[model samples]
Target: MAVEGGMKCVKYVLFCFNFISLFCGLALIAVGVVVQVSMHKTFRIMDVNASAGPIILIVVGLLTFFVAFFGCCGAWKENHCMVATFSFFLSLVVIAEIVAVVLGYIYRDKVKTMIDNNLSDMITNYKVGSAELRETLDKLQETWKCCGAQNSSDWKDYGSDGQSVPDSCCLEVKPGCGNGTMTDTAKVHQRGCSDVMSIFLKRDAQWVIIAAIVVAVLQLLGIVFACLLMRAIRGGYEVM
Candidate 1:
């Protein structure tokens, strides 16, 4: 049994969408790996709490990749069983993402606390940490234009070269630029990294939410189309 006319078009569109989803899954996996590796290389190798986000991304991506492939195969072959299975699995995936978003919103404060504590630990260990850690800290400070975990004053007794703030925190970003500049707001950034990250997330979070919504909508459409195709197949209507 197969579908005719519009059902045929729906079949091809579903296939195309699943093809696109496969690439999206690969992209998510790549991004997750990058984030996880970055976490490992910085902030004293993030604890399990900090590692959960990336691991979830990786798991979701892997599941998406396989399920989308299943969807594509079912659509192309017009197989009732495969199409039904794809629809069920895709629904589960969409539900899981929605749950993740809701949980993230509810636990946002805890996330902020974890980031703050990790950054503070890094600052506390900077004086005795390895060269790689120091370099990573310098890169972070330079990139964010932030002074310390909570502000420049947080470095009252700590620095790289017997100074109050590291040279990376200086406006000029040159050696000795931070010397005698802890009190000079013009010379060093007064804002803390934690605050900077918070500001950044507050400003950019809407974009992430928007993207998630769009993805969820697209997946829902795919699930709906797959179910329709399954129904047509079961009813012995030609969809090819």
Candidate 2:
């Protein structure tokens, strides 16, 4: 009777955990969609290719969605095979999340430098680029209230006459804000795009890491419950 009661307890606990996993999977999918849409609007506008980070979230979410079914069914029916399958998939997900966390940390440290280099190149070639590129840079400068990649000086050679900053860098909108024999520091943003973008990237990366940690914790819990239920089911069979 003790063994039967233990098995019943384990079964319900596993069911409850798996139920939570189902919603977690859906949440991940939603997060991925939001990230993708935001990246598409900003990065895509700058002609920067979107990273695989968001896609990874969606893939992991889909995998979790399917694996959760095995866990739910196994616990409810006391099926050893189903429970074992759940354990295997859950372990894989845990491993993947760990790898992602490590990579995320490494990337976070390098993001600022990478953005600096990319923005520098973009600023140097701003005038020779497509209209879309020009418009994107203009909008970025205005929205961030920033100037060139590293400062207004980075645009020393980018003006139409090769002596001023872009009009978008102006502290206030006006005609010929970018026209002069020399850059007019008094009329333009003083900050750099590199610094502004670096702060934004760091914040976004932190959130990604937090989300991964949460998912990893939940997966670990699911694995534990699945194992406990498996043992209880095996013991009950042996007693019969």
Using Cα atoms with residue i matched to residue i, what is each candidate's TM-score against the true structure?
0.85, 0.84
Per-residue lDDT of model 2, residues 1-240, tens digit only: 256565566678888888888887898899888988776545643335445667788898888888898999888888899999999999998998899899879867777677777777777678788887787788888888898877888887775566788888888867677666235667888788888878887898788789879878878987887888788777665311
List the lowest-lDDT window of 10 residues for candidate 1: 40-49
Per-residue lDDT for 114-185 in model 1, tens only? Answer: 668877777888889888778877888888888888888878778554447889889889887888788698
Candidate 1 global CA lDDT score: 0.81
Residue-pair clashes per candidate: 6, 0
**Whole-model lDDT values for every prediction:** 0.81, 0.78
Specify the highest-lDDT model's number. Answer: 1
Residue pairs of candidate 1 with colliding backbone atoms: 2-237, 2-238, 2-239, 3-238, 3-239, 4-238
